[model samples]
Target: MAETFAPVQPDNRMAAMSIVAATCFIALSTLFAKMLTTDALGPALSPFQVSHGRFVFALLFFVVGVAVIRPRLTRPHWGLHLARTGCGWGGVTLMFAAVAFIPMADATALSFTSPVFTLIFAVVLLGETVGWVRWAAVAVALTGAAVLLRPTPESFQPAALLALGAAVAMGTENIWIKKLTRREGRLQILLVNNLVGVVIASAALLAVGWQSPTSAQWGALAGVGLSMATAQSFYINGMARADASFVAPFIYGTLVFAALYDAVIFGAVPDWVSWLGAAIIVAGALLLAWREGRKRPTRLHPVAGVVK
Candidate 1:
């Protein structure tokens, strides 16, 4: 008798695990950012500077890493690279700007809207079909977003609009990245994105007159970039190994970390209403991920002739 093995499927568990690690790093990055930028330096730098510095450092780091790992670059996918770069840079700029204004957790929750946008983009730009179930999932996510924003008499923060814009750009970028992945390597994707971000952000800062940073501030900036870079690597590695449904909700758990960091570091905390909104957002996102899992058949495809 032949031995039988269980069927394997490409679940997003690894991606979900990546989210958890990424969230932690991101929370730390936010903490360092709030401290280094405001207290250490009397003058606050614009979002352009922070974003530019982060990308420049991140790109340099990635380049060095790639040189060591020496991952083979596939044929250039210029169209996909351009699309991803354009949308990603736009989103990054907007999100960073929002961070300069709002509490980190609130901005993060707003950024969660990116997936909702991605779902719509997949259907419209990628020509992918989403059944009514997924659309309903999307609707729930939107409802959660509304709860967070709450345009009624009290709960609105205009700064959140920047985060909402970031979501749109991020959503568009996700579609472009999905397209690029067909022909490009993951590091290559990061390379193009960082390059674009550095170029665009640096150019924007030139118009406003860039601020000189203290050595400590520079160190914090570098720290932010490095933490984010490591987070990305961890996410990629983790998601490759775990089931997505098992991992995604924990990624949202980053908000808890963010809130705690904000309170301890800046004495900031979201009101009860905001907390409720965050819960709704998480619930909706969970539904979307679950629905996504149901729609796709669970079977892992071998990549580059290697079983993951």
Candidate 2:
């Protein structure tokens, strides 16, 4: 039998640090991306270029990290790696579009829907059982998204939909990563996942034709890559040492950074209603974390078809 880890006591304090590190990096990256898109690089820069720059940096970072850390890059599961790559690229493409249009906080808030999609996919695709409480938590989270989007208006921006697409892609990516980690080392998994992104983004850039990014623009693009690479590395290291359920709530804390970035960088404060919606979203994320924390850690699930 697999050694069942205790739910509350995780092995890696460093992992917690990684999660925190990712939050900070993501927040800063959001601000940089907003600046790059709005001020330095115009919307004409295209999602393809943005994604290409992001993956290129991430791939370089992962490769260098593996060289220094000496993590084995065994190709244990190419198929799973490919799935994660596709999902990651899709999520990035959609999110870049969303961020280009919507406020960062709003985009972040909408992205929370991923966990809900994950939970549902777990039940349907993985055949995992979920109780009423989990279901209730999912509903609360969806309701919060509804409030934020206010779908009643046709004038509602498509950025909201793009955000949802990103969330769905990310949710699928998460499920696959959880499965991949079961048989793969954290660094190795990251290497393959990032390489996939680099390849896909490269193809997109080629098809769209590459842009000559200015020094400042390159920095923003590099920031996207560096921040994303750092965040994933930290998050995986943290998860290795801690219960995912315990660490999941910290993921929501990214919103605090998002709010700060929006306020200080763009002076893009969310309205009262938006704030309320954000609160609900955070609350739902917390509930989901609490729910997962209460459960016993079982053997990690196997990788399958995409969840969302």
Candidate 3:
């Protein structure tokens, strides 16, 4: 008798729900960061201070999670982990800097450029072949980004540039993460990511002079931490169950959630032009995701390989 194995089936419904949950949690984290840094709010925090709190609080939550789960701690890919850590930290720092100055919707829209950057990097660095349709989609996405940026003396802000920088760094980090996922468990990756973040953020906080958060601010910080951890876990769970292409489009939900949060919390509703640009960006991203999903393995023809 031959041994049989269970067939693997993808739970797309669960994956979609997980991605939605992750987007909501991420939006909540961003909302907390915004509130904490608003000048009108008592004890308004600096960007660096907010970044430090996010990582520190997130680390504590992860530590508790690791203790409860008892996942494997040892991994052989320290170099990759270090590179990912640096990229993740750079992305986070830049994003927080942007959030300190820009509206939430604009910042979120800018960050959506990461997928476009990732596509370019895949073609250039990984030598992947992309069809002209995908290339055209990339061009459209770039145009959308330019529309949002509107490079004029009055329209162009340094914070927008920082958001783009954050996207690039995050895109690169995600590439490394894809490689790591081939060999490492999700728990291991999360542990290293949070641990590195905590260490680097602590050092930076010391260099810049740490400010003690008020009791209310502490609650906001905790919200940031809790949301970050929850979002990461939900995203990982979703990605594990569904194809990357299927899950990628759902991640755009972050933009919607961000806009809603901005409207509710800051009373800052996006104008018509911003909405139009965001729609274009979302269209381009969905096109790219559709292309990715259509990729199929080429089959060898029986007659082609035979010697006549």
Candidate 4:
């Protein structure tokens, strides 16, 4: 029988710190990605080329890690893996495109809509029951997204749409991830995701002529890969060490970090309306996480039968 880990006592402080670190790394990754497509590199690289470089470097990192770790590899449910990979690749592509054209803060804020979409998918696809409160939370989140988007002909930007599309793809990918986690190791999932991303992005690059990146651009791409992988590691560690509810609230810190990066690096500050919308979205997500935490059965210690 596969050995199960003992239920870990929640470490709120460590979890909080880990999440903050994860958020910062994520912000750094976004900053690096945006740098690749901006005048900082002289002529901006194409979004596809940037995406290709990111996945290529990320895959190289994962391959080296895998060689060192030598994790057990299992082949189960390849179809679902492919589906999840497709959704994730699509999300990453759209997100990079959004970052190229939109403010980092806006793109990050809109990405939070993934959890709301995940809730909807859970209800419809997973046959999970969502009560009135959760529904209300979803509605509030959507309203916030609309407030940020502001959909006027003069105000609307297509990049905003791309961000939302990324959210939806990520949400669907999240559902698949939930299913896969029941049967796969973390490294296995990540390996497949990066591998597929590299393949898809490489194919896309072929269609659009690969642009040779300068030395500085190469450094930025390396940063993107390293930061992204480290961010995922930090986030997973944080969530594993603490309750999901506790860790989830801290995940919203990504928006704050992204906003700060936007201001400091890009000199673009979001307007008051955008800030308000971000607040609303964070509020709704917190509520949803709280409710979901309550719904989950508390794990009990084997000897004492006391909740851990």
Candidate 5:
């Protein structure tokens, strides 16, 4: 979706910081999700309801943003927005579901395989090229993911599969996002995506029989929505300034935060396999980031200040 070299602006610091900030919020979102989907808080809420709450509350935040900033709404890119929202809603719902059954670290690490899928989508859908180095990087990351999957029946966990599916869905969402960034303003992009997402999430919640959340669970759901909205903003802003692959490695920061929350709040210590798998995944992803950085230029376009 992007040029082989991203059309990066000179505000590299802002882009990098935005990605880092996104990672933090992303971890917070999943932390809340783990609480809501499990007894860590109260009666577990369904992933559909959790995801629905995510979209609704996030849309509410943007509504306030719109009322104040009053950004001149861009013409709708309906088809793209719909496709992106479908994948985003599904990916997050699957992830919220997975965190209910697996350790937050395990789910987060497996999701790290997303960039490999993002690279493949770029190559196939956009007709971009991927050299052997990138292919090798893909292999390394997949191996790490497989370590987490442990598909054999004895050690197998179906919940891990949900996280893997989320990775694919999220990776597809990444391509759509990168395409959107090159053409749209950041705030409007988020506003429209959430607008589309709330519609989808609401329909799914209805199908699943939505239930009222406990007061504590309501707070958790709000955390999912607000944190995800904030994370989405930073992620979108970062993508506007960097390639999707370039943004991928920095997201590994999320695993650290997720692991910390799990340990501190849930007291669910990670086993050796989780640590090992995550290390391998990060190694491969960071290598891809290093190569992508060396290849991308300092300034290929004037992408400074706000995307608008």
Candidate 6:
């Protein structure tokens, strides 16, 4: 007799809930990042320092994970790992910097535009076709981004551009992670990712001035690392268990969490513009995602982390 194994079935409900949990963690990570950039916590730390803490602490978490599980190792693809970690670090750092200057709600909404950028990257990097439907979707998302930017002198914030840059970097990371997941196990991918990330972040941190983080600052930095690590775990699980599009819409909940966290912690309430711009971005992203899902049911996957 041959031994048989149980095949896992898709549980849409669990996957959706997992995405919600991931969003909550991602928003919490942003809140912790914002707290670090404020003097109220202690000495305000630069985004480079914040990013450094994220990679270092997140690496520790993974190291503990590896020691406990002792995952099977494979030949490392150092170049691909470097590219993915480089983009991830850049995206994380820019978003951290942006949140320091603008409301988290606004920053989260702007970062949501990354899916559109991913579509553009797919076209160039993978030779994927973009018909009129995708182009229109991209245009709608960009328009929403413009609304979020508030281009007028009284409302314009240069820091918002940093958020947009983060989106671009994340979109590019999406391309690289897609390639990586094809050949690597999740544990291997994540382990190599953070290992490379710490190296890159350390180099950047050294170039910038470093100060000993205060006790409160250390707490905030630890929060950023742990929350983000938790988020990446849940996000990967969710994507593994469901079709990407089926769970992708649930990610918009990050904006809601960000706004709620902002209100409760920072007392920064999102006005009509924030709501409208966020609504528009979500609409366009959903449209684009669903359209692609119909065309290619099993191929789509979200970026490695929730919103990072």
Instruction: State candidate 1's TM-score.
Output: 0.73
Q: Per-residue lDDT for 1-308 in model 4, tens only?
A: 23332333445566557777988898789889889988797579987888788778878888898899987777756777888889988887787788778775577567667767777777677665667766766666666665755544422386788888998997787567655654566666677777888888889999999778899999998988888878866765565455433343455556657777888887988899878867876776567556655654455565443564
- Compose the digit string of candidate 6's lDDT tens values, residues 1-308: 12222222345556657777998998899889878977879878988898889878888898899889986666777788888888887887788788788876578567767766776777777565667766676666566655654544422378889988998998788667655655555666777887887888889888987989998899889989989888877766665555443443456557667777878887988789867867775686567556655653332324433311
**How does each model score on lDDT?**
0.65, 0.68, 0.70, 0.71, 0.75, 0.71
Per-residue lDDT of 107-224 in model 1, one digit per residue for the tens? 7667767766777777777676666655665566456555654544321388879988998887777666656544456676677667777887788889877888878778888987
- Which sections of candidate 2 miss by over 4 Å? 1-24, 41-44, 94-112, 126-129, 148-152, 155-166, 238-256, 288-308
Compared with the true structure, what per-residue lDDT tens digits does model 3 show for residues 1-308?
A: 12222212345566667877998899899888888987545678876788778887878888888789886555448888888889988897787788778875477567777866766666665455656766666666656655654444432486789888998998777566655654566666777777888888888888889777888888898888889888988876665544443454566567657767877777978788757766775686567556655655233233332212
Evaluated at residue 263, the lDDT of candidate 6 is 80
Span of ten consecutive residues with least summed lDDT in model 1: 1-10
Task: Indicate whether candidate 1 or candidate 3 has the larger lDDT.
Answer: 3
Q: What's the count of clashing pairs in each model shown?
A: 13, 1, 0, 0, 0, 0
Compute each candidate's TM-score over C-alphas: 0.73, 0.74, 0.73, 0.73, 0.78, 0.72
**207 in model 1: Cα distance from truth in Å?**
2.4
Where model 1 places Cα greater than 4 Å from the true spot, the runs are 1-9, 40-42, 92-112, 129-165, 234-256, 269-271, 288-297, 300-308
Measured by TM-score, the strongest candidate is 5
Decide which is better by lDDT, 2 or 3. 3
The better-scoring model by TM-score among 1 and 5 is 5
Q: Could you tell me the lDDT of residue 49 within candidate 5?
A: 87
Using lDDT as the measure, the top candidate is 5
Compose the digit string of candidate 5's lDDT tens values, residues 197-294.
Answer: 88887888889897778889988888999999999999988877765655555555666566667777779787888677667767866676667657
Q: Which parts of model 4 have CA positions greater than 4 angstroms off?
A: 1-24, 92-112, 141-166, 234-254, 269-271, 288-297, 300-308
